[model samples]
Target: MGDFAEAVRERVRRAREAVAAAHEAGDVYAVAEAREELDDALRMARDLGVDPGAGPEDEHEDPR
Candidate 1:
Protein backbone atom coordinates (compact mmCIF):
# COMPACT_ATOMS: atom_id res chain seq x y z
CA MET A 1 0.00 0.00 0.00
CA GLY A 2 1.06 3.55 -0.64
CA ASP A 3 1.68 6.04 2.14
CA PHE A 4 -1.81 7.52 2.03
CA ALA A 5 -3.55 4.14 2.31
CA GLU A 6 -1.15 3.01 4.98
CA ALA A 7 -1.81 6.18 6.94
CA VAL A 8 -5.58 5.70 6.69
CA ARG A 9 -5.21 2.10 7.84
CA GLU A 10 -3.23 3.27 10.84
CA ARG A 11 -5.87 5.87 11.63
CA VAL A 12 -8.53 3.18 11.46
CA ARG A 13 -6.53 0.97 13.78
CA ARG A 14 -6.07 3.80 16.25
CA ALA A 15 -9.74 4.69 16.06
CA ARG A 16 -10.66 1.08 16.83
CA GLU A 17 -8.37 1.06 19.82
CA ALA A 18 -9.81 4.37 21.02
CA VAL A 19 -13.32 3.01 20.73
CA ALA A 20 -12.40 -0.10 22.70
CA ALA A 21 -10.69 1.95 25.39
CA ALA A 22 -13.61 4.36 25.65
CA HIS A 23 -16.03 1.47 26.08
CA GLU A 24 -13.79 -0.14 28.65
CA ALA A 25 -13.64 3.09 30.64
CA GLY A 26 -17.44 3.18 30.63
CA ASP A 27 -17.56 6.78 29.46
CA VAL A 28 -20.59 7.33 27.27
CA TYR A 29 -19.31 10.61 25.87
CA ALA A 30 -15.91 9.23 25.02
CA VAL A 31 -17.44 6.14 23.52
CA ALA A 32 -19.65 8.27 21.29
CA GLU A 33 -16.75 10.46 20.25
CA ALA A 34 -14.59 7.45 19.51
CA ARG A 35 -17.37 5.89 17.50
CA GLU A 36 -17.60 9.04 15.43
CA GLU A 37 -13.88 8.98 14.85
CA LEU A 38 -14.00 5.33 13.85
CA ASP A 39 -16.82 6.06 11.44
CA ASP A 40 -14.86 8.88 9.91
CA ALA A 41 -11.81 6.67 9.58
CA LEU A 42 -13.81 3.93 7.92
CA ARG A 43 -15.33 6.43 5.53
CA MET A 44 -11.89 7.71 4.67
CA ALA A 45 -10.68 4.19 4.01
CA ARG A 46 -13.61 3.51 1.70
CA ASP A 47 -13.11 6.81 -0.09
CA LEU A 48 -9.46 6.02 -0.56
CA GLY A 49 -9.98 2.33 -1.37
CA VAL A 50 -8.04 1.25 1.65
CA ASP A 51 -10.00 -1.99 2.26
CA PRO A 52 -11.68 -1.21 5.56
CA GLY A 53 -13.48 -4.55 5.85
CA ALA A 54 -10.85 -6.26 7.93
CA GLY A 55 -10.04 -4.68 11.30
CA PRO A 56 -9.09 -5.48 14.88
CA GLU A 57 -12.42 -7.19 15.40
CA ASP A 58 -11.48 -9.59 12.67
CA GLU A 59 -8.31 -10.57 14.42
CA HIS A 60 -10.06 -12.83 16.91
CA GLU A 61 -12.84 -13.92 14.64
CA ASP A 62 -13.08 -17.58 13.69
CA PRO A 63 -12.35 -18.56 10.14
CA ARG A 64 -15.60 -20.51 10.06
Candidate 2:
Protein backbone atom coordinates (compact mmCIF):
# COMPACT_ATOMS: atom_id res chain seq x y z
CA MET A 1 0.00 0.00 0.00
CA GLY A 2 1.09 3.52 -0.73
CA ASP A 3 1.43 6.35 1.71
CA PHE A 4 -2.04 7.68 0.98
CA ALA A 5 -3.56 4.28 1.59
CA GLU A 6 -1.64 3.88 4.82
CA ALA A 7 -2.80 7.26 6.03
CA VAL A 8 -6.39 6.49 5.16
CA ARG A 9 -6.13 3.14 6.88
CA GLU A 10 -4.87 4.84 10.01
CA ARG A 11 -7.75 7.30 9.88
CA VAL A 12 -10.25 4.48 9.59
CA ARG A 13 -8.64 2.63 12.47
CA ARG A 14 -8.78 5.69 14.69
CA ALA A 15 -12.36 6.37 13.71
CA ARG A 16 -13.33 2.81 14.53
CA GLU A 17 -11.67 3.06 17.94
CA ALA A 18 -13.48 6.31 18.57
CA VAL A 19 -16.80 4.70 17.79
CA ALA A 20 -16.09 1.85 20.15
CA ALA A 21 -15.09 4.21 22.91
CA ALA A 22 -18.22 6.28 22.44
CA HIS A 23 -20.37 3.15 22.64
CA GLU A 24 -18.55 1.95 25.75
CA ALA A 25 -19.11 5.29 27.41
CA GLY A 26 -22.81 5.18 26.60
CA ASP A 27 -22.66 8.52 24.84
CA VAL A 28 -25.41 8.31 22.26
CA TYR A 29 -24.56 11.54 20.51
CA ALA A 30 -20.84 10.79 20.46
CA VAL A 31 -21.50 7.35 19.08
CA ALA A 32 -23.57 8.78 16.28
CA GLU A 33 -20.89 11.31 15.40
CA ALA A 34 -18.14 8.73 15.55
CA ARG A 35 -20.19 6.39 13.38
CA GLU A 36 -20.55 9.12 10.81
CA GLU A 37 -16.79 9.65 10.87
CA LEU A 38 -16.18 5.95 10.38
CA ASP A 39 -18.66 5.88 7.50
CA ASP A 40 -16.90 8.79 5.85
CA ALA A 41 -13.52 7.09 6.29
CA LEU A 42 -14.85 3.92 4.67
CA ARG A 43 -16.28 5.91 1.78
CA MET A 44 -13.02 7.73 1.34
CA ALA A 45 -11.08 4.50 1.28
CA ARG A 46 -13.43 3.09 -1.34
CA ASP A 47 -13.16 6.18 -3.48
CA LEU A 48 -9.40 6.04 -3.31
CA GLY A 49 -9.35 2.36 -4.27
CA VAL A 50 -7.72 1.49 -0.95
CA ASP A 51 -8.39 -1.88 0.67
CA PRO A 52 -8.88 -0.80 4.25
CA GLY A 53 -8.85 -4.37 5.50
CA ALA A 54 -11.42 -3.32 8.06
CA GLY A 55 -14.93 -3.73 6.76
CA PRO A 56 -18.02 -5.75 7.62
CA GLU A 57 -17.00 -8.52 5.21
CA ASP A 58 -13.59 -8.80 6.87
CA GLU A 59 -14.98 -9.06 10.38
CA HIS A 60 -14.28 -12.76 10.63
CA GLU A 61 -10.89 -12.71 9.00
CA ASP A 62 -7.71 -13.21 11.02
CA PRO A 63 -5.81 -10.02 11.71
CA ARG A 64 -2.53 -11.66 10.80
Candidate 3:
Protein backbone atom coordinates (compact mmCIF):
# COMPACT_ATOMS: atom_id res chain seq x y z
CA MET A 1 0.00 0.00 0.00
CA GLY A 2 2.75 2.39 0.94
CA ASP A 3 4.67 1.49 -2.21
CA PHE A 4 1.63 2.13 -4.37
CA ALA A 5 1.13 5.53 -2.75
CA GLU A 6 4.75 6.41 -3.30
CA ALA A 7 4.57 5.38 -6.97
CA VAL A 8 1.45 7.45 -7.55
CA ARG A 9 3.00 10.46 -5.84
CA GLU A 10 6.13 10.16 -7.93
CA ARG A 11 4.20 9.94 -11.18
CA VAL A 12 2.05 12.93 -10.28
CA ARG A 13 5.08 14.95 -9.31
CA ARG A 14 6.83 14.12 -12.56
CA ALA A 15 3.74 15.01 -14.58
CA ARG A 16 3.43 18.36 -12.86
CA GLU A 17 7.07 19.08 -13.49
CA ALA A 18 6.67 18.17 -17.13
CA VAL A 19 3.70 20.50 -17.42
CA ALA A 20 5.69 23.34 -15.94
CA ALA A 21 8.55 22.73 -18.31
CA ALA A 22 6.19 22.52 -21.25
CA HIS A 23 4.62 25.84 -20.30
CA GLU A 24 8.02 27.45 -20.01
CA ALA A 25 8.99 26.06 -23.41
CA GLY A 26 5.70 27.14 -25.01
CA ASP A 27 4.89 23.56 -26.04
CA VAL A 28 1.14 23.13 -26.06
CA TYR A 29 1.28 19.47 -27.11
CA ALA A 30 3.67 18.65 -24.32
CA VAL A 31 1.41 20.37 -21.87
CA ALA A 32 -1.53 18.29 -23.05
CA GLU A 33 0.50 15.10 -22.73
CA ALA A 34 1.52 16.03 -19.23
CA ARG A 35 -2.06 16.70 -18.28
CA GLU A 36 -3.04 13.25 -19.57
CA GLU A 37 -0.29 11.64 -17.55
CA LEU A 38 -1.39 13.51 -14.47
CA ASP A 39 -4.95 12.31 -14.98
CA ASP A 40 -3.72 8.73 -15.32
CA ALA A 41 -1.81 9.07 -12.07
CA LEU A 42 -4.89 10.37 -10.34
CA ARG A 43 -6.88 7.40 -11.62
CA MET A 44 -4.24 4.99 -10.38
CA ALA A 45 -4.27 6.68 -7.00
CA ARG A 46 -8.03 6.27 -6.84
CA ASP A 47 -7.67 2.60 -7.72
CA LEU A 48 -5.28 2.29 -4.81
CA GLY A 49 -7.99 3.53 -2.42
CA VAL A 50 -7.59 7.27 -2.68
CA ASP A 51 -10.94 9.00 -3.05
CA PRO A 52 -10.97 11.00 -6.27
CA GLY A 53 -14.13 12.84 -5.34
CA ALA A 54 -15.43 15.33 -2.82
CA GLY A 55 -15.19 14.56 0.83
CA PRO A 56 -18.09 14.38 3.29
CA GLU A 57 -18.12 18.13 3.77
CA ASP A 58 -18.41 18.62 0.03
CA GLU A 59 -21.01 15.92 -0.58
CA HIS A 60 -23.83 18.40 -0.99
CA GLU A 61 -22.24 19.80 -4.11
CA ASP A 62 -22.89 18.05 -7.44
CA PRO A 63 -19.87 16.03 -8.45
CA ARG A 64 -20.64 16.22 -12.12
Supply candidate 1's per-residue lDDT for 10. 88
Tell me each candidate's TM-score: 0.80, 0.82, 0.70
Backbone collision tally, model 2: 0
Error of 2 at 37 (Å): 0.4
Off by over 4 Å in 3: 51-64
Where does candidate 2 stray beyond 4 Å? 55-64
lDDT, candidate 2, 1-64, per-residue tens: 6888999999999988887788788888988898899889989999989987755425843112
Give candidate 1 misplaced runs (Cα > 4 Å): 56-64
Better of 1 and 2 by lDDT: 2
Error of 2 at 34 (Å): 0.2
Question: What's model 1's overall lDDT?
Answer: 0.79
Task: Show how many residue pairs clash in every candidate, following the order shown.
Answer: 0, 0, 0
On the 0 to 100 scale, the lDDT of residue 46 in model 1 is 84
Residues 1-64, model 1: lDDT tens digits: 6888888988998898888888778888988898899889999888877886686555763212
* Poorest 10 consecutive residues by lDDT, candidate 1: 55-64
